[model samples]
Target chain A: MTAPHEPIPGTTIFDGRMAMKGYPLNKMCYSFNEAAARQEFLADEDAYCAKFGLTDEQKTAIKERNALALLAAGGNIYYLAKFIGMLGLNVQDIGAQQTGMTVEEFKAKLKAAGN
Target chain B: MAKIVGGVTTSHIPAIGNAIANELFEDPYWKPFFDGYPKAREWLAEVKPDVAIVVYNDHGLNFFLDKMPTFSIGAAPEYQNKDEGWGLKPLPPYPGDPELSWHIIESLVNDEFDICSCQEMAVDHGFTVPMALLWPDQTQRPVRTIPVAVNTVQHPLPTPARCLKLGEAIGRAVASYPKDLKVVVLGTGGLSHQLDGERAGFINKDFDLMCLEKIVDEPEALAKYSIHDLVRLAGAQGAELILWLIMRGALGRKVSKVHSNYHIPISNTGAGLLVLESAA
Candidate 1:
């Protein structure tokens, strides 16, 4: 409670932690839970593509990118592929276990297990 | 010759910009919501303010999640669009009026309002959404702007009363400036919205209307309400409305509501807009 316009003395504005407290939803949790995000993930290829206006190349690129990220972290080939598929990516299953996974925990486990 | 043109309060939901610019409003989900604000569209064209001091809260875009400034003012000649991990939205860079900005900084300081001035910083959707809403045509950008960022995202967030006092200081700063330009201060964010777990989609129309009432007719009354009260009733995100009180305070004692629109087209969030002309 500093004086009006005193700027709290040494206040610095770049702290993201404080900024997120203002509207944490934009960054809350590791993944998006909004219906729109879920709907897009569940939509059929053509419908999804039409909605986001993404080209086939762009979609393919997203899949490759996610797959590369998974591989780099040594994720289970099968679950990683499933996760990609869930996002409507082009990757197919590589015979990995379908063990229930929380996306954040899964990433952490993948990293810990590999490293 | 800086004249107080009035004040504007609006919700700055990031999705609104994409919905409007990409014409996604036609999507059944978003279209009906914006259609509710025909008067806002008309007012934007009618008032056509010459300059706007936009008050908004940055969501860790320009400032990282690590360090937060309670308030920062942009005094740069131009502000570039930022890339918030999702890639940059290809909008033209905003042209700033540095001379007027410096004048504001000096006047505010003289009036005992310590302001942090920035020459180069990327502004996020919090700044752009309202800009796009009121100036969709990008016509004159008629309002050369003084961008004011508030730290609404963090705890120990500034109290509603504190924000109002700051607004009064801002009004003094603008009123005392020696230039000659019509200035409108735009306060961005909230009517009543909660975008968090379990409480996501909370909308309190009653609280929203009360806010509209108090902001225009009795801003001092609103100062009694706390961030806790807003969070408990309207949800945490709704607390951002504290920024509006600052605009109201800047305008001072009595303000005539020129136009106001409140709509809830999105989950747990009420999108509202209002324009106020100073009593003088």
Candidate 2:
């Protein structure tokens, strides 16, 4: 969890504390590995959230499609990624959203890592 | 004795899977990353390892937060790649060596590292992308696989030092096996890139470059780093560099870095590939 460790700026380590908090959100996303779960979530997003028994904050984060908010709510990127992809978004899209950049700008930053 | 031939380590990102599926080898945007593979494939062809012990982390596929094991090894007859939500086309089941797997499990446990021996496990891109890259044509397969997943999904993960020792244990296990076999160790993922938090776009080419070099010779230098140090320098997801260390520890003490490729922005990752030979 959030065991008092030196902080990495802007990074949230998905530790046990976060894992416990994000369980419902993550479990819901983990289900997306199945095509049926994906369809079911898509058909009734609210009902799906209710089924997972997600916290109000987690539900709000999902509703807003906010990557940072989701992280703050203890979402693990591995599973949150499934939820993001289910909504027709990719990692780059989430990167851009979290960094407050356009997807192209985010990609440019990534490409610049080579130089 | 099964000779520990060497190691091949590469990025197992989901994006690369899409590129391979679409045959984007020549696509200008993807060429730099995809171009890094031919040498590795060539090396794989020459060595022709009979068994590949793949070191990767399960990205919420075979594992979940419900009960996370620090280290898990696959002992199933065959391993299947499944729909990990992105709907990347699942590849055919990669054959497994339950005998080798059980042997390794027994050895590692006997080596004092508790291991979860799994009879059924679903491998995600972490396990498949590298398989596809090394064996794009399927002919390169028929080489059985044993997956050793070091937990990277959760924090307080086994340290870089621990994973390398685990790999060393694996090398010892393979070496002690009664059967004579040519074994290859695969370290997949990382060269630094993060996928979550406000630091999502983080990538450190310098650190990755340092690792690509050190891992070939003095892996202990890399092992000196803690999991926190890795996440700090490599990015959260970039912490996967531990996988490479595990692969490195499994190689011979005197190692030759036969081939290596490093490219940036391979889908929010610093894609790296290395083909090593434990020289005679």
Give the per-residue lDDT digits (tens) of candidate 2, residues B58-78: 998889988899999999999
Q: Which residue ranges in model 2 land beyond 4 Å of their true spot? A: A1-3
- Per-model TM-score (chain A alone): 0.26, 0.94
Question: How is the predicted docking of candidate 1 categorized under the CAPRI scheme?
Answer: incorrect
Q: Which candidate number has the best DockQ?
A: 2
User: What value does the lDDT take at residue A111 in candidate 2?
Assistant: 89
In order, the candidates keep a fraction of the true contacts of: 0.01, 0.90
lDDT of 1 by residue, B6-110 (tens): 888888875686578677756876665666556665665666666788898876556633456777889998876654333335577788888878877777777
Give the runs in model 1 whose Cα sits over 4 Å from its true position: A1-115, B25-28, B36-38, B138-140
| Every candidate's CA RMSD | 12.9, 1.2
Clash pairs, model 2 backbone = A1-A16, A1-A17
Task: Evaluate every candidate with DockQ and list the scores.
Answer: 0.04, 0.87
Residue A30 miss distance in model 2 (angstroms): 0.6
